[model samples]
Target: MEDAMQFAPSENPALATYSPEVRQQLFRFVLQLADTSLILGHRLSEWCGHGPILEQDLAMANIALDLLGETRSLYQYAAELEGQGRTEDDLAYLRSATEYRNPLLVEQPNGDFADTVVRQFLFDNFHYHFLKQLVNNADERLAAIAEKSLKEATYHLKWSSEWVIRLGDGTEESHRRVEKSIAELWRFSGELTIPTALEKELQTIGLIPEYADIQASMTAHAERVMEEASLVIPQQVFMLTGGKDGRHTEHLGYILTELQYMQRTYPGMTW
Candidate 1:
């Protein structure tokens, strides 16, 4: 049982007294969480009209709705912290494709049921550990959010994990399909655990946990889940990075083009 909220500034006097750089770094990390949820929610929304079954179609939409709401709250708080007066809408829609910091795995197209499951499986596994780390943040507001969201993410991970088992241990075609999806997505996970300099500063100040510690826990969790599911981990050692640095895959560019079309077409458009 790791102390989730110990590092949150609102909960810890020492962390509340950290240097300005440390505080900003912690805020940036929070933005990454918000951005990730927003991007994934959007990706999931594509399933609303396209699911294989009516029940699955509605369920995916509900999940997307949940993610979008969570991301909205997270980014709204981030905007407030920045003091730039930017709204969550601004952060999500006004930014260009390159400005979005979501990992490539999330933005990648949902090829099939297998691809979607593998993508979500990877994301949920990573998020489970990320939320655990954030729960111990020195920033109380963020720590509290993490604590609440961790419960939701836990359910998401469980659902995806079960799907992995169902698909991986199914017929030979099912196994091969999921294995291929896993292999394709495996290379994109490197950026999830690699902390930037800003994150390092926050870690040193106790505003957030160290990336190395979270990575180790996340790796073990993923390995155990896959092992139980009778799946082999992809052996690819090469990994893609730079998404955190604002360099994104081309798929993101197209996604942004579609998502931002109405806003860009009518600059002051509002509900």
Candidate 2:
């Protein structure tokens, strides 16, 4: 059997037992989750020295580091599950833009302090629900990792939500900026709740929760936070989606170029 921290292919002959379509769906879903964490962490790392305040600078950088660490575990587990002789570094830094499975929200530029807060706010809420569901994922190791990660994600959501409230109610200028950021970013959020066909299958089989249930929990939590902050939720219904199907913005290429620079240049040199 695979150890708690290691997944050996032979142990899960179930990998071979499952249909090719099911295997592919599971692999793609894992890759998408890992890619989202990796990209978002990279984006947040860009704010290390540029946050609005010294305290916020430290806070954002800490969260960025935590996200990168999470990405490492996710990528490592993915590579092992795929058994393709690929390291986490190879899977992460070596992938082409079109191969990346991160959602569009994480790839969007961090425009300003308010923009960053709102972006984190939306994603943190989504992560909270996603991780909660994954805590009981049919795959044992994946479920264990998700259970551990839920703790870290919970703190992130709490801290970011506080900032959302503070920025939204702090001052006229702050309120206007955060409100605008929320409005601009709301369209990207619908995708988080819209499960793919594979997701539906998993949910029906008890591998995951229904998307509607997750969305309802998320909406209740989000509305409560917004209400406490005296902020109104944006009423946008139109949404854009494509990340799940391998479409990405041009910005990802540049980001990948930078992320992969050392690895591509140095090949196998390790410290």
Candidate 3:
């Protein structure tokens, strides 16, 4: 048997099975998850004190903290898997925009309260469903992380789902705003659910579930929430992708500019 659990040697101990190619794919897969969380967390952190209301301001901050916490665990695991002598901070702070594999949805600017809410809703639904299955996947290491993160993702989905309904059914203005936000963000929603080359390989090797594994459940939740919200998902529209392939939109550069500034400037500064 291919040493399923002993992914790496004692020095790293991330993944011990599969060929070098599979290991490489899994490394990228883990980084994709970590990068997605880190970027989304950063975007939410941007709204820290700028939310439309005090209660919502605190809520957004709390969600951002939760995502950042997940990001830390993922990056630490990625660092170990890479066996590259890199730390979590190094991986988080040192990467260029094109080097990141996060879907474009998270890197998008928080346009308005409605924009943030819609983005969180779409992703939170998918995150909850995906993590639920991920806990039983091939890799116990990543599954352990997924198990803990799923707890937080549960709250995240509830919060976002409630906000989706609240905003969509609240007032004419709120409903209109969220509708507009959905149009802008919906194109990016398919990227994560659609498999990438690496993601497909991981599925083929039984290392992870195919991205489609969560789509049905995720879509069902979205339909239910959207129905409750009096909103309709737009069909027949073109969806934008490519973030997982390291091709990204213009926004990622600006994000990295601010994100990498401290580390690039000081080279080794710590708070």
Candidate 4:
């Protein structure tokens, strides 16, 4: 809901030249990125004072802040492209669960500390590589955003990966917990690489990278990290879908309830 345009102008000359269809596709792609980070940040924020240790509590909170910051920037840009006078707040706080475009992986419940870490590890791995490729996107504004976000994504990946290794290589109980987390979350991860129709269009226009390449890189990195952590990568299975199309898991409704309560209760409220 924050105004991220303060950091950078929303205007992009290149975007102005796009045809209506391509412009809409770009808006959808940007919204997907924003929604993913916004939802994940909200999830991580729930662990603020609930982390297993004070250090971890603060770490997760900081990471959540980073994700939210990125979300604000993406939302700001997306709103500008829509050119309907919608602010970041309107796009974020007023949207229904079905209107959201975040993948299911980020919306799943953060079961326990280990579950949170495993989820973060998986998403961070994909995010890091995805942003890496996005940095070279033909859209200059998007590439700039990606260039800035990749730094934070790198740290997020490192932090989550370390926790995954620590827990997996720690006590037997810890290992069991993270292993379970992996199995439960792996099904949701496949959707990360399966580009939406909008994303495919962007890829064709060079506005986005090829999802197949991104998936391959993400898989290799994830497998290597799992091996180092002494954890087994679950076999590929049926991947969950529909989040990108605005269909979401039931968990998203609960998340939106809490997240939208303040805004709905006090319309136009700002810190």
Best by TM-score: 4
All-Cα superposition RMSD per candidate: 4.5, 3.1, 4.5, 1.6
Residue-level lDDT of model 1, residues 75-139, one tens digit each, is: 76677566577876788779887777777778888889899888988888888888888887757
Q: For model 4, how does the per-residue alpha-carbon lDDT over 1-271 read when each residue is reduced to its tens digit? A: 3424344443567876889888888888899999999999999999988999899999999889989988988988888888899988899999999899999999999999988998898889989999999898788888888888899999999999998989889999999999989888888888888888887778877788888887877878888888888998887578998898899999999999999998999999888
Best by the lDDT measure: 4
Per-residue error for 80 in candidate 2, Å, reads: 2.0
What TM value does model 4 have? 0.96
lDDT of all predictions: 0.78, 0.80, 0.86, 0.88
For candidate 4, which ten residues in a row score worst on lDDT? 1-10
Residue 226 of model 3 has an lDDT of 96
What is the descending TM-score order?
4, 3, 2, 1
Candidate 4: which pairs clash? none
RMSD of 2: 3.1
- Candidate 2 lDDT over residue span 205-235, tens digit each: 6656677878888999899889877788878
Query: Model 1 off-target regions past 4 Å?
Result: 1-20
lDDT of 3 by residue, 47-133 (tens): 987988899899988888888878877777787778789988888898888899999999999998889989998889888898999
Cα RMSD, model 3: 4.5
